[model samples]
Target: LVSEEELARVEARLRSINQFAPVMHCTHSSVSVDQVLNIHGFDLQRALKASPELLNTSAAPTKHDARVSSVSLDQSAPRHLRTVQKGELDLDLLQEWIGELLNNSGEDIFRMKGVLAVAHAGKRFVYHAVHMTFNGCFDEPWDDEARESKLVFIGK
Candidate 1:
């Protein structure tokens, strides 16, 4: 079990990465099945009443610096699968890229997470960056799946 202060740090870390800390409650410190299921709905009213901290935090920690209503893209359609050449990427280079991204973002970049299929690497790696910090870890191999970089970053 964690105290409220510890959970606050966790929630802050998650918010840094564009993720929300899950809220679970029960009648007692030891939870029963029914109590767990009862809050499963996660209704706004119930959540607000349960945790007043939610009110203190920003509901949408994003940007609206511009009054622009809509953004027009250069390309009419989504461009998927922009291919890369063999030997184009390696573990070290990947790390450098992630580092540069985080460092350059300052704090405008809130949350980013993705999976990369690095070239010339056997096992896949999971990448996570939150609040100017980034980490990469060894993941299972592709097995029957294809090796490809599927990454997305959400920022201001």
Candidate 2:
């Protein structure tokens, strides 16, 4: 379990990101994908284009890809596990959803972070994105001991 102070620090980091960044999200659900390319505070469109796969959910992703699990704007609420695709994802649809979140002003989103399970570079990968920033991305063997991705979002 994470300590209260640790959680507080993490939250602070998230708030900093929100103050300066704009991200993409899913309309049907609270899940959103951070545009890493545009994270240094760059063009929203360019950021979306750089990793269009992160935005859309209409294109069939490979059998394995970095995917969101679930999102919640309630900190006390447990974030349910969600996968973009049972086997693969539709990138276009996912992207469209993200775009919707960006345009919605009343969205209760405050902060988000998750571990993305991905298959890349001929190996399994794990990606962590906090707020709209890429926290970490690494390739690992499938047998490594790692917990499933978890995320907690604070509502406005």
- Cα-based lDDT at residue 99, candidate 1: 79
- Per-residue lDDT over 1-156 for candidate 2, one digit per residue giving the tens place of the 0 to 100 score: 567797678767876645445434335545534545434675667656656665678877657333423443332234363432222223355345544653562244444444333433323334333344333444565466442333444334
TM-scores of the candidates are 0.48, 0.28
User: Model 2: runs farther than 4 Å from truth?
Assistant: 1-96, 105-107, 119-143, 146-149
> Over the full model, what C-alpha lDDT does candidate 1 score relative to the true structure?
0.63
Q: How many residue pairs clash in each candidate?
A: 1, 18
Model 1 spans > 4 angstroms off:
1-88
Location of the lowest summed lDDT over 10 successive residues in candidate 2: 82-91
Tens-digit lDDT string for candidate 1 (1-156): 779898788778766753334545534567666655655545677666765667776565557665323222222134553333323257787787777877877476666776677777678888777778777787898788766566666666
Residue 30 C-alpha lDDT in model 1: 72
